[model samples]
Target chain A: MLRAAVEAGADAVYCGFQNATNARNFAGLNFTPKELQDGVAYAHTRGTKVLLALNSFASEGRFELWKHAAECGADCGVDAFIVADIGVASHLANQLPQQRLHLSVQAAASNPEAINFYCREFGIARAVLPRLLTITEIRNLKNEVDCEIETFVFGNHGLMVEGRCSLTNYAVGVSTNMDGACSPASHVRYERDATGGMTANLGDHVIDCFAPCDQAGYPTICKGRYRTPVREEPYYAFEEPVSINLMDMLPELIGAGVDAFKIEGRQRSRTYAGQVVGAFRKAIDAILAGQSPNPIDLIGLTEGHKQTQGAFLTKKWR
Target chain B: MSITPLAKLTLGPILFHWDAAAKCDFYARIADECPIDTVYIGEVVCSKRTPFFERHLPEVIERLERGGKTVVLSTLAEVVLPRERKMTTELCAQSDYLVEVNNGAGLGPIAGRPHRIGPTLNVYNVQSMVHLASRGADHFTLPAEIPGNVAALIGAAARPIGVGIEVQVFGRAPLALSARCFHARAHGRSKDDCRFVCEADPDGLQLSTLSGGPFLAINGIQTLSWGYVNLGAELDAMCAAGICYFRLMPHRTDMVTVAKIFFDRLAGLSSPDEAGACLSALGLGPFENGFWHGRAGHLYHTEPEH
Candidate 1:
């Protein structure tokens, strides 16, 4: 996939080590220490940079693990470490001052003041902005802060506050901020009722239900269907399972001072990532070449065959 | 006689919006009647709602100060706009007042200056706590879902500077925040023209699952626990664990009486049993302290699961 991304015109590719060191802590994904070394070698040989994600919040006895991951990642010749925890950032800034650091979107640094603090404290060169900021806000943030700004342009338009949410912690007994897994598969259950309706659950809590004719969405816990009197039909109580597609607003994003674009779903299969990566690569190239940034068809690739402009295009306050 | 516990009752910043008159009346009552040691005044949840309440702030602060309580201003949890930045910067620059920062975005203005760090800033361990302490924060409200043992560990590291640790002992523990407004989306209203509908739910609008189980509450950009987390049972141990301040997040309840119960219990006037019994009348939701016991945050554990 790294090679595929490279061949498809991706400037950088992010991957995680095969441990609790990253957010996508599924069973079969992520690289081992040896695999990380080889992956970095492969990306570098193909003229691409590899980023190591160490975005989880390090708690009481778990600080050493994050520190070790950084050392090992550096040893593996990765370009930078994407961090969120204050301790990890402070540690990396002081211990490995020469290494590059990028503030993960999980840091929730939506404003320049937060971005400035990260840059000052951790010596971070870039900050991955949260999925929350609007394009206008992004432009304002870029003017206020000195660091490079990256924003999510595709995948999982999460409605819950990332890095601060405990909905998963309240259910699955796993910390999304600390453990890096949101609604881990071990605690998930898909139950089918006699009426041919499917219910998705986190632990014992019912998240969403789908009828026979309805397309079932991923049980992300937050994006679950719910009952509310304000609305007639059973609706997505928090957010619809719509993947973000900013391709329609690429020119505006570029004009809004975005330094780079990010794609979520590192846990997905290689082919899925490569296809999305290729489409986005073409769109970005078209925009940079002073041509029309044509909207590439990506609906079939989306989670629910639906997409949203998300918080970026929406007016914030009424 | 035993030394007074000095366990202060604090009124955390209001995470909801009511009419300015309602807010002013609530604060007037707090100043005149409540036994809260400190009152956090400011709109912490949304920046747009601040204007409606800003005019009442000076008088409210005066009344609270005259009533012999400290008043702290809070910066927004999610800082995105230029106006919000200016507001946070000006608040941080004010030396006459103490500002509680809910995000790292407000840190620059308060850097090397006295301030309070709110729960949303992510102080999980001793290292993170000490790091923030070195940057001039004197007060830390451990995040809503932080377990007791972890708070104790962070508290021990806070001793050198008299950096007092605080915890939410009452009201619905705010679980998360988002840039998107779920409340507006529910009413088929856009965020820009929603007409501040959250004012209707003085506490918060309850959101339940399709199975009819109460789940979360929508408080504008904030997502709160449907269950009001009452820590009356854990107050004794929490106070003993270097937690000096107990914060009651403002909800639509008889806050003054609620303060009295916690105050009485802290002063050894009321039993934990009595305080626990008193909270039932507030008619919030179920009591849950499982987060303190290292279990799922939404569950109330009678005994340690482990």
Candidate 2:
């Protein structure tokens, strides 16, 4: 997947170890140290950068796990380390002073003061802004902070505030902040109900039930249907299963002084990564040449085959 | 021979959108009668709701101070708008009262000054706690979903550093916060023109699963558990683990009685069994302690009696 993304015109590729040190701690996913070293060599030879993500919050007795992962990444000669925990960031800054550090979006540093606090405290050179800010808010934040700003342009739309949300932890024992997974597949169960409908359950709680004709998305707590007094039928209380696609607003985001564009596809296939990256690369090149980029169609890669330009167009989304 | 100090009872900031008169009355009762030692006052959820009670703060602060209660101002949990940033900055600039920062934006302004870290801010481990403690954070309210073992680890680490640790021991546990307002969205209105509809539910709007089981509560952008977190059974254990403060989140229910219940429990006047019976009689619906027992937050696990 790293080779496919780099070959498809990605200037940078971020990967993580297959452990709890990173956020995507799923089975049969992520890279080993040997794979990372080989992938870094391949990307660097092709003039691309490889970034290692160590974004989970460190537990009390297990702080050494993150430190070990950081040392492993450094040994593999990665370009930069993306970190979320302050303890890990402080460690990296003190131990590897020459290594560049970028604040992960899991830190939820939405404003200038928060971004500046990371930069001043840990010598962060860049920050990935949380996915909640509008373009105007992003531009305003970019002017006050001292670090480069990155924004998510496409893929998984996590509507909740990152790093602070504990919905998954509430329903199940694991958490996105601590355990690096949300509604982990180990506890998710799907069964056919008596009414010819499919019901998705996380632990013992029913997330939602879909009819025969409906497409059932992943049962993330945020994108689940629930019963309420104000409505008769179960409804999407928080958000619908839709991926965020900022393809149409690329020029606006670039004009807003965004330093980088991130596509969230940590769990996707190589084909998805290649096709999406290739399309984005073409559009970005056209915009750089001062030509109006053609509208790109990548709906096949979205969740539930649905997409929305969330929060970037307006703060009224709240 | 070491003597452990008795835990202090704190009243958390009101997270709902109540009318100004009702807020004043609530604070008045808290001031005149409640046994809580510390009172946190501010709009910690939404910035728009701040103006409704802003005019009454001076009187509220005066009344609480005169009543011998320590008052702290809390910033919003989520800061996104330009005005929200400005609000947090102005909040940190004030020297008249101690501040409790709920978001990362509040850290820089209050870096060198004495402040408290609210439960909304993540302080998962001792390293994170010590990092914030080095920057003038004297007290910290750990996140709601952490188990007792993790809390004990943090509590043990905080002893020699001379900083304080707090945990939410009562009221509905906050689960998640979003950039979009679920309350307004459910009412067919956008956030820009929400018309303050959330004022209708003084406690919070109930959210249930499709099977009619009460699952959660929605307060604008904040999501909370439907079951009240009653740690009555674990108060003694937590105190033994070096926790210094017990926080009670404000609800529309009789919070004065709630504070008295916890106060009596911590004071050793009532056993865990007696306190558990009294708390259950409040009719606050179901109670849960699974988050503390290293299980799901919504599930309850009755502790074995000592």
Candidate 3:
């Protein structure tokens, strides 16, 4: 699936180590050292770049682990490193001066000054923009900054603070920034309530309860519904469980100087990755060729059986 | 062993609404009475509130500086408009005070300058911290959810690079910031035409779960933990971990007393128990330090030193 992504249209295939060195650190996903070496080789052979994700924050007294992971990734002959930490990025840039570095979206370098600083000091070649940008803001950022820009085109729409937010950790004791998992599956449990509805609980928090007819996604704190003083009823306080589909907005994003479009699931199955990557590849190619791309049939892949353009379509209330 | 008096106090930007006169009076009082070392002033929640405080900022900054406070201008948590970006850029260019890049929109203009990374910036690990420090960030205010161990590690790593670390100490913790304003939506108004109704609840409206348990608070688009976070007791552990600064976010209550409680704790004049008792008298709520101890943020895992 990764090889196909490179061959189809991807400029770079970003993957993470199996451990907590990356944000998508899940139970049965990501690459080992040997797997990363083989993956890099496969992409290199096909003239595609391999970007290693070491984006998760290194915990106290555990800096050496993240440092070693970077060294191993460099040894694997990866094309570039996507990083969020200043300490890690600086270490890699100082040790491997010739290696390319891309600021991970987790870094949340949303402004030109921040991007320029990364480029000048650590030689960052690209930055994965946070999902909070408007089309006009992207154009302005491109004009103000020298490095390449990447945007998320599909997957869970993260509306919280990118890179720095720890709301999940506050709620459930795990966070994507430190632990590389938000509302991790280990803490999640589903049980049939007295009403015969399945209640999904993350830690002690009941995130959602669904009837037999309802579809469910992973129980995340931000996607959970709650009753607020302003609203008399329970509604999504942060954001609804929705996937970001920019298939229709591809031309606009591309025209706004977006250098790359990122697909957000590394924990996804190889089949899911291949299908989404292939569809986006075709859509992007069609747009570049001045033809209207066919709408992607991605309803089956959506969470809660729904999708939205998220912040890209302006502010959402639900 | 006594903890060293190395904990620096920072005043976070006011996240609530106040009249221009009251806002001016707040800073005036901080300048005259608060023992805080740094004061962050500017609109962090909504841009509309910026205009109200904008006219008073220059004077307030002057007063703060006269009182020997290192003033900082903060940026909006969510920046979706071109004007908002422009405002961030202008604030960044104000060479008189350091800038706190709360969101990514503010980073571009102030990159490679001596700036403070706000909690909203979501810096969870050493790599992200080092990245910001290399970009001329001399200091960082970690996200509220960062565990003490992680904070200590980041602080230790940052020490060699000559970067300072600050953690949120008092006030309702800021959980999330979004483009949609629940305060306006609740009042049946759009964000574009929000009637400045957030002023109704200076400390944010408390939210309860469906079962009537306290869950969170809503201040505009931001979702905050309903429990106030008081780290007066964690000073020794944090100081041992190499943290140099502790931030107390502004609240509607007695901020001077809040600052004094921390000051007294640091001075050994008051124990963590005494400080915690005083915190209750200030009328916030039950306190929690679980997130600081690497537990649930809302859970009070550590027993207070009563």
Candidate 4:
């Protein structure tokens, strides 16, 4: 899957170590140390680059573990380190000056000053932008900053605060920024209710209950239904389950100074990864070749069978 | 015996919707009774909630100042509109009080001037801390999601620069902020037409999952934990790590008592267990300090007495 991504069109294929140091710290997924070395060799052979994700914040004495992962990544001949913690990024940049550094989306570098600071101090080559910026904002930021920009082209639309979020930890005690998993499956439980509907619970909180006819997505804190005083009726308080598909807006984003397009879901099946990556690879090539890109309907792969351009459209309602 | 405890207590900006008069009265009471050394006053969660208290802010600040408390003005957590930016810039221009930069846009105007970096800025490590300090930040409220070990490292690195460290001690943990208003959406309105719906729930609304279990709370665009975080027991450890301030987020009921409980713990007049018990009695909901202890943030792990 990742090989196809590199072969088809991705400038860098970002994955994480099989540890809690990265945000997608899931079970039976992510690359082991040995697998990471092998993956890097494989990607390099195909003229592709591999970026290691050590994006989660490191605790006090546990800094050595995250630092060790970066050192190990460099030793394995990885292309660059995708980092969130300023401490970890500084450490790796200082320890291995020749190795490239890319700011993780978790860093949430939404402005030029913040991006410039990372570029000036850490020599960051590129920054994966947060999902909150508009196209105009992205264009302005690209002009103001020196580093290349990568934006999410397809995947979960996180309308989140970025970097300061503690929703998952507050529920089940692990956070994407800290422990690398939001609403981890270990703490999540599903059960059948008296109404014969299945209820999804993250820790002690019942996130959602679905009828027999409904399709259930992963149990996450943000994508849950809840009642508030304003409505006095249950509705998605934070956001609905919507996936972002900007395949149609590729030209606009590319024209807006986007250097790369990121496809989310490192935990997805390799088959799904290869399919999406190959499609995007061909799409980008078509755009470059002055041909209309073929329509790629990824509805089956979407989280809720709904798609949005997210903040890019600038529709005040979101 | 030494009289003074190691650190000071800061009252975090009111995150809930209190009627303008009630909001002013709350701060007035804090000035009269609470032993807090600093008080932050501003609308951080929603901009629509700001106008309600705008007229009374001057009086509230004066009363807090009269009570010998160092008052600071805080910026909004998420600033997307041009009008919001203008308001924040005007607030930052006031050199009378310290400005806590909650967003990066707020930080740019106050660069090279002494200010505070709020928890929303994501100060996770020594490098970010140093970077902010170099840009004129003398104090920082570390993100609430950080584990104790990470807090300790930041504390150690910040010591040389004399930058004060503050941590959220009580009230619902603010999980995330967004530009979109969930409250408005719930009421079938856009963010601009919110119509002040948040005013009904002074402490925000409790959100239960489908099975009627406490899940999370929604206050405008901010999502918070169902449990109130009580770090009274961890005060000693945090003090040892060189933390200079402990923040207590305002709630709807018995805030004076809440402040006193924290003050007593800081002053060595009471123990953490006693404070925790007091918190339970007040019905602020279940309390958890797991994140501080480097465990699951929602789980309570009782510590052995030293």
Best by lDDT: 2
> Residues B140-200, candidate 3, lDDT per residue (tens digit)?
8988888887888888888888888999988888877766777776676767777888888
lDDT by residue (tens digit), candidate 4, A155-249:
88887856667887777767778678877889988888787778788888888778977876667777888765445567877777888888999
Candidate 2: true interface contacts recovered: 0.75
Candidate 3 lDDT, tens digit per residue, A225-248?
777666667776666788888888
DockQ-based class of model 1? medium
Where model 1 places Cα greater than 4 Å from the true spot, the runs are: A1-4, A293-295, A316-318, B1-6, B268-271, B304-306
- Each model's TM-score? 0.95, 0.97, 0.90, 0.91
**Candidate 2 CAPRI grade:** medium
Ten contiguous residues with the weakest lDDT in model 3 chain B: B1-10
Ranking by TM-score: 2, 1, 4, 3
TM-score, candidate number 4: 0.91
Judged by DockQ cut-offs, is candidate 3 incorrect, acceptable, medium or high? acceptable
Superior candidate under DockQ, 1 versus 4: 1
Interface RMSD (Å), every candidate: 2.0, 1.0, 3.2, 2.5
Evaluated on CA atoms against the true complex, candidate 3 attains a DockQ of 0.46
Q: Residue A91 deviation, candidate 2, in Å?
A: 1.7
Candidate 2 per-residue C-alpha lDDT over A215-301 given as tens digits, one digit per residue, 9 for 90 to 100:
767788898999888878788898888999999999999999999999976788989999999999999999999999988899989
DockQ versus reference, model 4: 0.51
Accuracy of chain B in candidate 3 (TM-score): 0.95
